[model samples]
Target: MRKTIALFVLTLVICSCVSATPIAVAEGEADRFESWNETDFLKDFVSNNLDRTVATAGEEKAGDYVLSVLEKMGYTTRKDNGLTSAKQRFDYVDSINGDANVGYNIVARKDVSGATEFVIIGCHYDNLTSYELNGEKVGGEGAGEATGVAVMLKLAYDLRYETLPFNVVFVAFGGNQLGLYGAEKFIGANQSIVDNTLLMLNLDSVGVGDYLYMYADEVSTKHEDFVYDLSEKLNLDVRKPPKDKKIVAAKIRDDSKLPYHHKGLLSENSLFLDYGVNTLNLFGYNWTGEGYGGESENHPDIVGTKRDTLSNYLAYYSESGQKKMETATALVKAAVTAEDFSAVMKESKKEKFDYSWLVSDKVRIGVSLGILAVLAAAAALVYVKLDKIQKNSKKAEDKSDDFQKQSEKVFEDF
Candidate 1:
């Protein structure tokens, strides 16, 4: 009886310890970002074949690679060659249009279920004149501009199986280094898409710095507050300069300021901003110059140099890549799940409950105790049954021994 009780207690203790462990759910969704490795594609983008220069054979190779990937992922891809129209509309398009070879804008479109609107995400794939360590202009292929392309490709792969509420269009703009010609051409050709675009998120050079910078001019959509709120929700160190200030293009020595209402002065998101489409230009580098009361060197230098290869920036790639992935994930989640930016930002302000804590020690202990009680009762029932069987077996053994002795005594008397 004492042994049965001890065995029952031991069973209860074993069951209690097992119950306290975290439960694994077989139906949980897999993480999409984990499978999307940025460096593997980055290597291909920076290879010698995809030289990414203006009107070069290498540029065509890069465009072909992008198109192939989009097709493999089951996206409807198209090319936008609006440079002829760009030349007719703007006087500044003369320099870039000199080359008879047309610059192609690779666009991949995916329609979401019940989506009434479209979200255009873009990045420039063209690289400017490569510079040396001493700031000397050199003639070579460019890899600095490839980072944005790599990021966009990763986003497309991660969101391939996702069903969002808004149509998503991923664009790789050519001739971006010449000017914002590719963006201008896209806007010129896709008038209908521009009109219904819910937001335009531009990814440019997101491989360098620790900080994530989002730029919007005065004419851009009123998305500063929403972006700030979203960044806080995702825990990204974001820097968004004021509209009245000039910081975005100061390091590059361009007129990429907020009051860029002029067609000649354009960033990648210029036309979208001009047409009142909500635009967010996500860059990892921050420029600190006279406009922001500091020197340009105070900020981390941007790509566009020969040294801006994958090997050079590979050290911090994981950190910057994680931030970009998190930002994209949060933005897409909010866009797909929310009715408007206001609702998204408002929800970010609410106190979010961490359901992960449910499996922590405190809750686990309570659950373990309940499970232990039930297991103890079951163990007690099992012990009583086994104890009765043992006693009955002993009684049967004694009866057999007595029968054998009686038979032997009868045989001896005979």
Candidate 2:
């Protein structure tokens, strides 16, 4: 029975495998997400705000920038002395250099289902800070860091409209370049909450708008396969993570217990592994992690540095491909698939399903089976009837002949 079910699942998988081209429907078909565009609200948001990512830790303006975006997306805002809202909160990491210095983590979630499963997707919004040097603010802004924030914004906006498989918390963390302070605080305060999380995807930098990069291990292949497969179908430039980084996951090894932040640590992200969730953490880079999922539209050298500027974040990065936008969309679609966005769409919007072709293939397969079965049954029945008729006819002929012979012999004798 299990084998039969597995075969059926395999058949369904083949039938549902995402195609190179989006499915074509007759006129007036419901819009299936062929190209899941990530440029909805966040792109606009990030393009405008990349400069602020380099602001000092606990910068009110930087925190507010993220806050405004969340509020626009319909989330209630909360603020504490060391916190802002559920989405934006404060933390002090002394090791990273701070008193009760302020840093914010903006968090928000869409309540799709009960908290049976929880997936946390996050990115650091704070970039490398500008330290005062020689009475002048030395080059402010971390290289590659602003791009990370921009990508996070884009992701946050994308998730706002998406129907998620589980309750997805979008966290905008601060202080990654500075000893992972922001991430540590968030994870530490919410260790139990983090533990309950099913999956976590950390998008550090997503789009130079050229190619896609995925970071994962063998355990993440199921999720990674979806991305790679989609990339193949789209013929896009999709790259993999470096060898050392691949082993990193949702939990890590510590003195006694596995720390939250290790190659396999839930310290910050990779929550997706808990619930079999798939995820990726992209960073802005030049040649290696170039393009959309690799590097955002930011200069890699200035990332995690104060020298980072808006110019560092806005140039459209393109490699030889279809139009940059088209390629970017393709990569986004692939990530969404690996992220299980399609499932969310299908399950959440079940009412919108197209009933026309819902069972068309099944009906067609059934028709073929039915026709062959009927033909075989008819052939067998016909052969049996013909055989019986032939035998009966021979018996009658033999009996009649015998009678005639006997009668003739008796007449002759008499």
Top model number, lDDT: 1
Model 1 weakest 10-residue run by lDDT? 1-10
lDDT of 1: 0.54
lDDT of 1 at 62: 64
lDDT of 2 by residue, 161-279 (tens): 56545555667776444444455556656655565554456665444333445554334344456556677877876566544442222223111121223322322343333322344
Q: Show model 1 residue runs off by greater than 4 Å.
A: 1-34, 48-50, 76-97, 113-116, 129-141, 219-222, 242-244, 247-266, 289-302, 315-318, 321-336, 339-414
The TM-score values for the models, in the order shown, are 0.60, 0.53
Best by TM-score: 1
C-alpha lDDT values of all predictions: 0.54, 0.45
> What lDDT tens digits, residue by residue, belong to model 1 across residues 255-287?
222322321123477656555566777665434
What TM-score would candidate 2 get against the native?
A: 0.53
Q: Which stretches of candidate 2 lie over 4 Å from their true place?
A: 1-58, 77-85, 96-98, 132-144, 208-211, 218-220, 242-279, 286-300, 315-414
* Error at 205, model 2, angstroms: 3.2
